[model samples]
Target: MSEDRISRDTEVLVVGLGRFGSALAATLERLGREVLAVETDEYLVQQWSHRLPVIEADATNPEALEQLGAEDFQVAVVGVGTSLEASVLITANLVDLEVPQIWAKAVSAEHGRILRRIGAHHVVYPEYDAGARVAHMVSGRMLDYIEMEDGFTIVKMRPPRETHGFTLGESKIREKYGVAVIGVKPPGEPFEYATDSTHIGADDLLIVSGDTNLLEAFAHRP
Candidate 1:
């Protein structure tokens, strides 16, 4: 497959309408991209009617995917993590069909490596990442967050009450906490990213990006 020929605007086919697939389909559709999702179960397909063009078909079948104009889509995601055989088959089909970019979800590191060997452009371990997120949420003071990469994360958190009214510089957050305040969401204004002059307000939600440990420590700060 010639991966370099794939266009950015090409439609995306997501195989599987489970949690990961459903969310990915919705996000791609919202981004103004054409998305075709496939699920083996009729009930699951019905549940995602409002999200995208979902079809009741087994993704492991190359013919089923070809019927949905799979050739027209440059990107595809195989999200059937529950069944290793299904995931592998779907990925192989996508690769054989010459889909330029294939992303497959794997249950483990070994599975992910195997998927990549079969032409998956990227392998995602959703279960492991989701577990980390759940643990972060369960730990009080960590409101919400996203990891931009292995080293950095952007988190939305309520600053400790003691830090209210403190300017970014005054608080010495960057030096003391080892976190960079990327933005602040005040009561009535939009979010403001780090600048020369930004302060922490009582009602503000600090939008920070830095080391994960720093963010976690800030979360537990009293």
Candidate 2:
């Protein structure tokens, strides 16, 4: 709904008209993007038909996707998270079609593993991201968290008061918190990932990566 949302008519194929997929399609449509919503459930297809161009077809079928002109689309989003079988199949089909950008919604680590193996360009866990953001808000440490793998995460946070004037090596975060300061974004400056000797400042945003437990522990430390 924001006026800043770009209105480009880029072609995007959407598989599975579930809650996530439907929401994605509607948002993209509002942004003036061409969305082709595909669903295996006839009931869901009918429900969203009024607001979207619905196709009641199984995305597991490679031929169905081909007929739907999925390969022609610049991007594809597979949002069947409930059923791992369906999600994996649809992701594989998209890969086979050579979709340039394939983003799949994964419910679990195992599900993400299979999706990536089959060639999902990006795997997202909506629930996990929301939970992490909420957790950070309560602790007042991280601005955001991005999961890189099952156990590892990247955390964005302002430099702690204790680390206000210390250089990266002086802080000894790798030894104390078991995290690596990968990048720093100072106020009004572009992010720098190669800053090892740069001193931490009150306004500098630190990007660090470590296990979730380690990151959370560091975030809550006094």
Q: Highest lDDT: give the candidate number.
A: 1
Query: What does the lDDT read for residue 86 in candidate 1?
Result: 93
Reference-based TM-score, model 1:
0.86
TM-score for candidate 2: 0.62
Please identify model 1 stretches exceeding 4 Å from their true place: 1-8, 46-51
> For all candidates, what are the clash counts?
0, 0
lDDT score of residue 88 within candidate 2: 90
TM-scores, all candidates, are: 0.86, 0.62
lDDT of 1 by residue, 155-207 (tens): 88888766788888778888888998888889888877866478888888888
lDDT of 2 by residue, 41-68 (tens): 8899889999989888888989988898
lDDT for model 2, please.
0.84
Q: Please give the lDDT score for candidate 1.
A: 0.85
Per-prediction CA RMSD (Å)? 2.5, 7.2
Model 2 residue 123 CA deviation (Å) reads 1.0
Best by TM-score: 1
